[model samples]
Each structure stands twice: as structure tokens, then as C-alpha cells.
Target chain A: MQKVMMGNHALSWGAKLSRAEVIAAYPITPQTEVVELLSNMCADGSLKAEFIKVESEHSAMAASMGAAAAGARTFTATSSQGLALMHEVLHWATGARLPIVMGNINRAMAPPWTIWTEQTDSIAQRDTGWIQIYTSSIQEIMDSVIQAYKVAEQVYLPVMVVLDSFVLSHTNENCDIPDQDKVDAYLPRFENAYRLNTDKPAAFGGLTGPDWYYELRYKIEKDTERSLDLFEETGKEFGEMFGREYGLVETYKLDDADTVLVASASIASTARPAIDQLREEGHKVGLVRIRVFRPFPSELLRKLLAGRKKVLVIDRNISFGMSGAFYAETKAALYNEKKAPPMWGYIAGLGGRDVPLNVIRDMIEQTIAEEHPEGDIVWIGVKR
Target chain B: MLEIRFHGRGGQGTVVASKVLAFAVAREGRFVQTFPEYGVERRGAPVVAFTRIDDQKIYIRSKIYEPDHLLVLDPTLIGAIDVTEGLKPGGWIIINSDKPAKDFPQFAGFKVATVDATSIAVKHRLGSAAAPIVNSAIMGAFAKITGFVGIEAVREAVHELSPVKKDENVEAAQEAYDTAEVPKEQS
Candidate 1:
């Protein structure tokens, strides 16, 4: 059954197929359609789930944390200011290791009331412990949602599946949605090593002494490191059952390429074709689409970019006065590697202005042409 | 290849028109892609939804900045956004308007087709003229204009999206199809 569905529809269907036990969302922009579909599914008895009408994004996260704490799979969604409103709770959800899944439809912040797509929303909240996965297509949106539940439950880390605001969130694609029974076989049940119940009756988040706190924090980091492999194993097992694979670093035409563009979200679709066009014109260009943004995948990224001549990162969100957000992450990922290519960051599409293929082509060609590639950042496609 | 761009407000079934058209066209064994481009997806924002129908896959992602056929649900968007932005030379435009096609010569390419879809929607008991959701009807017009899709296919697509108001929407679609006039093609 092939049908054109927007990213929002994909997210709803993804959550539905995951057999999400609880869903709480407040209507917002591109995100409204997703919650609408899920609510309709709940109302019509197709999804047999509890669709909570939360008053705000804050309450949405709170409800998800509650459901997750109760040992049931939970899901919620928000965008822009709504996501910002849940900023503090986002940290709490991840810190509590509730394994809640959320969809953040990327949207620009307000000053002049713009609802367009941008990466600022999610990128602003990157420091939180949640495993952030950005989607480039509706298919990925669906696939990632299911995988997100699996990964979050495995690692005890909440996951945020981020997609572009009106662009990817509302754009329709002929995505293949897996059957429910098959999805059930792949993602079975949520059995947490730490849970809330009368029998267990233990404090989930409690005060810690300064003496044991350092080691406990170190253990959390160590557990996160260990979960990286667990996440990969779960994704592979998911692919074996449902026939769609996912990973932290998804390489596209990077083999034997002299230059590669690192990006995420719907921009990957645009970059793929642009890379093909550049390659056809006898340019050695490719793309590295980051599926998993958290845990950074530094080692895998370093291994992949080892042989490439130059790597350019296109960050849709800026770190304000600093360089691009992912720009520093990628630099650190490749640092101390053997003969690594000079990496440059090109920030574009900050406010949902389209990141055109022509600009991608221009950036790659300019990077390839540069003798030194000396600048800290190369701002591509700027009028001024 | 017949590509139609629907121009309307956010809640006017503009995006669904593209989807239904694609679904109907897909039934006719043609490869199709339908999508909408709008900033906010809000209630009253001007939106552009496009459908590409051909024997091949659509690789062009850029806005139908130019369209071979135009379906304008809100005539006011005619002046707001260029209803004829990328309309092919001499392309036909089917608009829901009270005025005759001759009065909007400036907006139409060489050929203009007008239908009182709002009044039709009203007569069919669809809604008030203020928020006349002429999407299904306009999609029906799209079918008749190009004959790329049949009434049965449009009905099936409409059913997939919803079952309520099926009969009225089907009739509205059929009326638009029967009344829509095709203009001469450009070289």
C-alpha cells in the first residue's frame, strides 16, 4: 500500500504502530495534524490508546514521563516555542531515564511571528541527555519513530525525533508503512531495568551525596557508552523484522569521495541529488546524513571521513555568537585522527529559507577549490 | 505530463486537492506526486499545492513555480500571490469566482476558465461562500479539464480521505469537470 503521506501523518502512524500506550500532545503548527490523526485513531478505537489532551507542551512531557514511569510505552509531540516551553522538563525526562519518545517539528522562534521551519528549536535543546535523531524523509520519520521506542527503552534515554517545520513535517511522500503485526514482532514490550511499582517501590530520581555523585555521573556516561552498541543491535534487529535499517551515521556515496557534506533532516534529500549532480559533473562529492545526533557517533564519523579529502558541514541552526553547533562537534569527532581532511562549516537555511542545491553545489565546489580552506566557517548562500 | 497547481487558503482543502488528484491520476496508471508549500499551515494563509502527472517519476522538487494548469479556489489569492506565476504560456486557469473569465484577463495566461464553484458549493450544501471548500469540486474540475482521471477514481480518492459529504462533493467535482474549459497549449 503506497500512499503519499506528510511527515506528520508518518509520525502518527509510527506512534500508532509502535502500540504507544499513552500519547499527550498540544496542537501546534505542522505538529497539529500528527496529534489530530493520533487522537482520531484513539477516538475511533483503532489504536486502543489513551490520548491525553494536555494543556501545554509542559504537561505533554509530564504526562509522557508519568506513563513511561508506569512502565508503558509513551509518546508526545511539540514544536518551536512549545518545545522551548518544555525545555526544563526535557532535561528532567532524560535525566530520570524515562525512555519517553517525542517528535519535535522544527520551527523558527518568534520576534515577528514566523512559523517557518528551522533547526534552532531542537539544536537549542541539544545539551539534554535525550538521544536526538533527525529525519530527512517521511519514510525515515516513520521508521525512526519505531526505532526510537526500541532504542530509548534499551538505553533508558528519552528520544526526540526531529523533522523540519512545514517542510518535512507537512510535505507528502510515498512512504511504505510496515504492518502492525510485523511491527509488534520487532518492538515487543517495554521492560525497564528501573521502573515504578509497589513491588519495586524504589526512588527513581533521588538526592545523591557529593561523595558518590561523581562516580554516579561517570556511571551514567559509561552506561550511555555501553548503550551505543545496544542501540545499534536494536536497530539491526528491528531491520531484520521490519526490513528497514537505521544507524547513527548513514553514509551516502561517501566511498572514494574527495569531499562530503554532513547534514541531517529533510536537507539530506536535497543534498543527495545535489551530490549526484556534482558527481556527474566529474566532482568527487558525497553526503553523510547523521541519523543519531546524540552520543555524537564520533568514532564512526572519524572512521568514515578518514580517507575523504575535505568535509563540509551544513548546519541549519547556529550557536548564536559562536560557530555552527555541529561544526564544533564534527571537528572534535575527526580531531587527532590520521591525516584528517580540513573540515569547514557552512551555515544555511537558518530561518527556513530553502537550502537550495545550487548553494550546496557552490559550497562543495568552493571547498574543493580552496588551497587552504582557512576560515573557521564559510557562510554559504548569503546575499550580503 | 499534466501538472496542476491549486491556489487557496490553508483550510480550503487545497493540499487535499493535490493529493486526491494524485490518487485519481495514480488510478489511471500514471506516476504522480502531490505536495503543498506553505509557511504556517494555518487556517487562512495563502497556500500552493501542486500535482505532477506523467509516465515518469517526478524529480523536480522546486515549487511548480510554473504550472501547466491552475486551479484557484480563492480568487483573492489571484492578486496576493501570482496565480499565474509559472503557468505555461496560454495555460488554462480554472477559478472559483463570481466574475466572468473575461474580467480577469490580466491574471490569466492567454486562456481563462471561470466557475462559480462557491455558488456550486453553496447549492450543493457544502458550506457558506466565506469558507467554500471547493477542493473536491476543484479536483473534480481538474479531472474533467484534462480527462486524466475519471469520476469513479476521484470518488474513490475522496472516500479514502473521508466518507462524509461524499455524494455532494462527488457532484460538485463532476460539475467542475464538465464546465472546466481547456485552453490551447504552448509550443
Candidate 2:
């Protein structure tokens, strides 16, 4: 059925549809509504799941890890500071090979104190071995949650479904909620032979010397890489069942374009119209929206961006002294390619500052007017 | 796509009003998106919300600027803030006021309409008389003035979304729809 719901409620509905066996989450702005709805569903008996109330975000991940370690489909959500609190356990969940699906609202990290959207929080965890999938709309957020569990369980690696804070999290839109029976057919029950069982006495995550630790780390990396294909296969199968099919990267008007815009999360959604306007004005502009950030989709990006006149990357999060994270990643992905385009990095819309269509148009125009990038990072709409 | 910007105080159901309207529009098989100003909301503070209705899925995530119409839940917000800052000329400006549309001379070029939503909300016992919830009545007035959505859809949306006083809210919308004051010249 089609329902108008906030992205947070969509996450809750996704978790309920996936039949998450255990939900452990701490309340934070934007992310609080996700857990609130899930708790309500649990209380109303609509979804039968063990809702674990944790005192902190750290405990939330720890409990989720514990639940997943016991062979249960565990889900948890947090944003910004809350997500920062789970950094240590985030690594442990991956190292333990637990397929815990977490919904992390991409709120900007605070010292100045903000609860608004930014991609830096989630991008900081890029090395944590968790598969990151950034979503742009409420519908994708809901669909990705179920797909996250499917891909995570197949590869035995945790998946972090990241979305913009207020842009997608608080915004309400009409989304088609997949039927429960259809979802059941798409994603079966979670079963793991390595689950902690009393009958089969085994010690887990005790300690490993370099002799075994190196191989263990290698195995994690190998499986993390394998998730790319699993995610694609699962998405294709899901599309066969449900109407919406997702991909690692979604391209808009890129078939015969000279300039391409690279963006993730809600920024990518906003870029579509900017691209359309630019196209109407006779500018050969297009968009390459990076949906799956982890496993990077480097090959797909390299193929799409090669031979283009220029590629402008708009990042909502800054990587401090460097450029935008996506900018750096895209550049690195295309470094060896002979036909690689001259890439320009732009940082815009941090801390909930709006990235209107005009700002996006400005980025494209600046990139088009310049012969080469003047600086490592071009800050858009920032006061000098 | 038809874009609407809603103006109201924080204590009022400004955001919910946008969502309820979006819900109603979506129920009619059109695509809709609604969201509030991304800020720390406090009661009585000026708040703004936006809703976009389109025949196809909306891809623009930015807040609405140059809205096709405006929904002002609080009449006091007119001069306090530029309620019509980016409103398109000739677009409908639906306001919740006891006075007629002609009372607001500043909105000469636009199609103006008014409904005493506060009185209607209070009469229906939707909220306390001091701070009655006027969103439902304003939505009804919106339905009546613009005909963007049907009155039945508004009632159904209010019935589905209102946590308490569901019937009262539905009745408030019906009464406002019945008595909404749209200038015949503009209509």
C-alpha cells in the first residue's frame, strides 16, 4: 500500500518488514523517530521482535552485535554523535562476521553542535569494513533496508544504510510499502551455522596472533569485496519481485554528455533537476549518483566518467585538510585510466545549509568555464 | 509540479498541516513531498513548511522557493515575516483569518481567500480556545479555494493522521470547506 511517511518511519517499516529479530537503538534527533516507531510496532504486536532498549549508542551497537552473534537478524540506528559512539563496536561487528544491518542518519559531527545532515559522519567509517549504501529518497531507504539484510547475510558483513538527516530522514513522501508476504518471499529467515550455541561449545573472538589474525583480516576484506556482486544479484532479484530496482550507481543523461556531476545522498536527488535544466539550456551535463559508497563501485564510475570533458563532484561533507571524500575517492578510482577526465571537488551544504538547484548550477557552470581545477577544493556558497 | 509554502507559529501544526495535505494529495494517486524548515522548532516561533505535488515522482530534495501557492495558518505572520516572499504572482494565498480576503490589500495581484479556522477549530473543540489547532480548517479552506485536493480526501487524511480528536478535526475541515470565503472575482 502507498503511504505518506517520513524517512525515519520508512526505516522502521523496513525493519519490521525484514522481521528484525532484535532491535537495539538509542534516541537521537532525526534518528529517534526510527526507534520510536519500531518500539510502537513491537508494543502493538504488529511486529514480533525483541526490542532492546539501550542506554547509549555504544550499548546499542554492542547489544545489536550480541543479538546478531546469537544468529538473530539484528537492526539498530543512530546519527552523528550517536554513530560516533558506535565506532569501536562497528569494527567488532565486521570483524566478528556478524551481518547486522544498521541505519545511520548522516548528521554532521558536532563541536559547534549540530543535528543537521552531513556525510562526513558515515564517510569517516569507510575503513570500518561495513558495507555503506547511501540512499536518496524515502522509498529507497525502505527498500535498501530489506536489501541490506539480504546482502549482509549473504556476505556475513554488516551493512550501514546511510541517509541524509533532515533531507530524507524528516521529510515525508509517498512510498509504496511492499507487502509482508512478498517481502517474506524475497528475504527468508536468517540462519547461521556459526551462531553461538550452548550445545556446541566454542570460544569466539578470544585472541589471535599475527599468524591467524592476518588471514582473518584478509577473509573479511575478501568477503566485503564479494558483497558488491551479491548486492547487485539481490537487487536484481528484488526488482523482479518488487517494482523498484536499485544499482550501485544511478546515472542520469550520461550517455552522450561531456560534463558529469557526481553526488550522493539527497544531493544527488536534487542534481537531477539541475541536470535537466542544464540540458534544456544546451549544456551537455549529466549526473552519476553513487548509491553504494562501499565497495566504492570504482569500476562503474571509472567506466562512466572516462573520456568526459570534466567531472564535478559535490560533497556535503568535508574531509578536513583533503577534499570531499567522494571527490578524493572518485579521483583515486580514475587515476590510472588514460582517458580520465579532469575532476573538480566541491564542498557544499554542510550542517543543513540548503543545496538549491542554483548552487548546483553554479558548480557546473564554474567547472565548465574553468580550463582546470584552480584549487583542491572549491567551497560553494561559503562566506569568506 | 505545484509547490506550496506553509507559514505558521511553532505551537501550531504547521508541519503536520503540510504532511496531512501531502497525504491527501498522494491518496488521490499523485506524487507528493512535504517537509518543514530544517531547524530547532520551538513553540510560538515562526515556522515554515513546504509541500510539492506532482504527477510524477519528485526528485528535487531542496526546500521550495517561488512556491506556486501559499498557505498561511496564522494571519499574524503576514507582516512579521515575508509570507509571500517567493510566492508566485496570481497564485492563491489562503489565510486563516476571520476577515474577508479584501482585508489583506498587500496581496492584490494574488488570488486571496480566508477562513476563520481558529473559530472553527474552537467550535469543534479541536484544541483549547486560547490556542486552537487550525491546520485542519485551513486545509479545508485550501481544498475549497484551490481545488487542488478534494474535501473528502482532506477529511480522510485528517481522520488517518490526527492522533486525538479525529472526528472533531474532520468536522472542523468540513465546516471550513463549507464556509471558506473565496473572493468571487479571484475564484
Runs in model 1 with CA error above 4 Å?
A: A28-31, B1-4, B9-12, B26-33, B39-45, B52-69, B74-81, B87-119, B129-131, B147-150, B162-164, B179-187
Q: Compared with the true structure, what per-residue lDDT tens digits does model 2 show for residues A189-255? A: 9898799999998999998898899999989988887887887888899899997888899899999
Clashing pairs in 2: none
TM-score of each: 0.89, 0.99
What is the iRMS for every candidate structure?
Answer: 2.7, 0.7
Off by over 4 Å in 2: A28-30
Per-candidate Cα lDDT values, in order, are: 0.80, 0.91
Q: Pick the candidate with the highest lDDT.
A: 2
Q: What's the TM for model 1?
A: 0.89
Model 2, residue A24: C-alpha shift (Å): 0.7
Q: How accurate locally is residue B76 in candidate 2, as Cα lDDT from 0 to 100?
A: 91
